[model samples]
Target: MELLRNARDAGARNIYVASVLRRRRYRTLTVLDDGQGVDERYATLIFEPGVTTRHLNPTIEAVDPNSPPHGAGLSLYHIRNLAVRSSLLSAASPTSITVTFDTRVLPERSLQSTTRPSRSNLRATVENFARTSRTSAFYYAQPAKILASLIKNHIIHNDESAVELVELAEALGLRISTRTAQKIKNGEIPAIERIDGSGDGGRRRVMTERGGEVDGSTALLDLGDEQMSRIAVILREAAHASYVEVHDLRQSSRPGEITLTARVREPEDEYE
Candidate 1:
């Protein structure tokens, strides 16, 4: 998001972001944007777990026009849990929409075993066009598409020092002020959560509804902006770096039991 250039775009002209700290001393992040808003029909489903614009685009005619579930019910439900009270501000024009994520409760574990290997959608799109066409393909394309998403969303870079993210942002052509950089970094949730050694003698955090801790693949770290920037750098480093990603040291523990697993799979196979 070349801020100076993109600020004039109709889709994201009115975007604003902030962190709301609650009485319980928890954090709820809010993003108000003038992008194409979520339709009222999809409002209830936007935060439902696993719901995505990609899936919703294909099934508009299959379901009733007037219905409870617009699409995937789980992602929004998962969003509800992560952010506590979640909703689309959709305040003014249909294009102006907002999403709020609460940092009080825990994140979903259904996809805890899941790993999101990042890719450059912009490049992928162009590459798809190049396929079966010509050797002189989408060339010189670098980090522009992802850069726009990062800039437009005004990402929350996790727990890193302000100077760190700023330098990277400059590399990606982000013209954000230092004040905005601090704001983005401040929204990061802690990466290394303390295990409860007291209960059963440990202060353990559990994601399972049964109160049994699922120690493997928990969010040991949040992908703050700087972290995401680091990821972009890694992806750009390798032309073969399709779906490349970056992460910090993440560990999960419990007083009595803990689990850890790391594996890789092909593009079609899901990661666990």
Candidate 2:
């Protein structure tokens, strides 16, 4: 129920829910949507209680009449606690999400998976995704190099200092605490490190523990359609390229390697 709500809130116009029988004992349930899927970065964070991307007073109602209309983020968290095995998959461009559940595994592995989800790690992931997806507008060949150049050319000068990043965040009207800024500068937050540019040229620098490397897994970014559009405009104008697109490089040699590619946006390209 909560998963459905999340998809609806993410501006999904079409949603599909499926269930399959596994060996007549285990049941597999799946929900697929064309909405603003969970960001590759926020996949696990969404399983944490009290974490929500929806507005404070979202118009969407709860799937259950007894549940609160707010705090849709808690839905999946609670469900994960009760369910057996679950996964969240999302992609950019089309902003598709697929959530699956394998209830058969819960009874046996519940004890082994009792550790609470990491809030700090989730916060860092979200912060990075927000900053980068909101800022970077284009992807190009040699994305990492181009991004580094863009930051040096426009966002930052040369020195990569914590204080400078904090100041930069403030200048851009983003709320970053001293501790958070320091963590980002030090690369403690492996998802995103810094965001640069203002107006139409906003860009973000993402850092990851595993750089440019993916083992056939999807990493979602927690960005909205409006945010991507603005960034595309900025990158398009700045790169002087006819095309601009954003993609998650799960298989990169560098950690947090977001590529800027040249693919002109069309009506069907809208993520929402």
Candidate 3:
């Protein structure tokens, strides 16, 4: 039902649904569409709470004031919350959303045997599985979106060290390596990059560079300035009491000159 809503929201006139048992205990549910597909930038974020592209346009609120709040972007989020594993594959030519559900709790023989159960019994089992899958919700809820942008801005403007950024990330509950921080600083880890689909509307591909090897797809993180600032302040306060984002250290440095500043708030009032 939620997938249908997303397909309609994407302006897909004809959506195809396919289900198959890939392994003994795994089932894949794929939804194919021909519409304005999601960009690679928001591929992963579409499942995060309160993220949406549908809200960009003027919705039908003016036509019907009594309408419920639309474009919460919660459909995919909830779908992901329900599924054991989920994925979104989008292309300019053809868009698709695929989700996998684990049916391992029930033996494969029970569902796929020659002596199949009644339609009502099978439906009940499927519904029960859906209900119970919520126990395995995704839990990586650190403010990574904010932390990524904060690190990017600090690297560009404040000349913050990778070590410092990693420290701050860890302080704020995000665990990233020094190499990842360097990649982000060097623009190798872009916030977003376009994927080139094949001429025959084949699979979507994203190119990435790591250890001199061009790798497969990478998703982008979309973090707004306001969100970054708010989360930064919160994280800073939590990590170090009373210290804030002061720019006095950069006043005397030449443009692009790297310098590290260690600021401590003195109880006595004194200006640096």
Ranking by TM-score: 3, 2, 1
lDDT by residue for model 2 (87-153), tens: 5644432232333345455422221212222212222222233332332222211112222322433
TM-score of each: 0.26, 0.33, 0.36
Per-candidate total of colliding backbone pairs: 24, 24, 0
lDDT minimum window of 10 residues, candidate 2: 111-120
* Candidate 3 TM-score over all chains jointly: 0.36
For model 3, how does the per-residue alpha-carbon lDDT over 1-272 read when each residue is reduced to its tens digit?
46644654566543444445555566555554455778778876888987877756534433367886565888788778767777775443345676766766433334432222321233223233223232211111112332344343332132568887677544433446888766655755543211122231111333222322221223323445675576556555654555443322221222212223434444444454
User: What C-alpha lDDT do the candidate models reach, one value each?
Assistant: 0.37, 0.43, 0.47
Instruction: Tell me model 1's lDDT, rounded to 2 decimals.
Output: 0.37
Tell me the RMSD of model 2 versus the true structure: 21.2
Whole-structure CA lDDT of model 3: 0.47
User: Candidate 3: RMSD over Cα atoms?
Assistant: 21.9
The candidate scoring highest on TM-score is 3
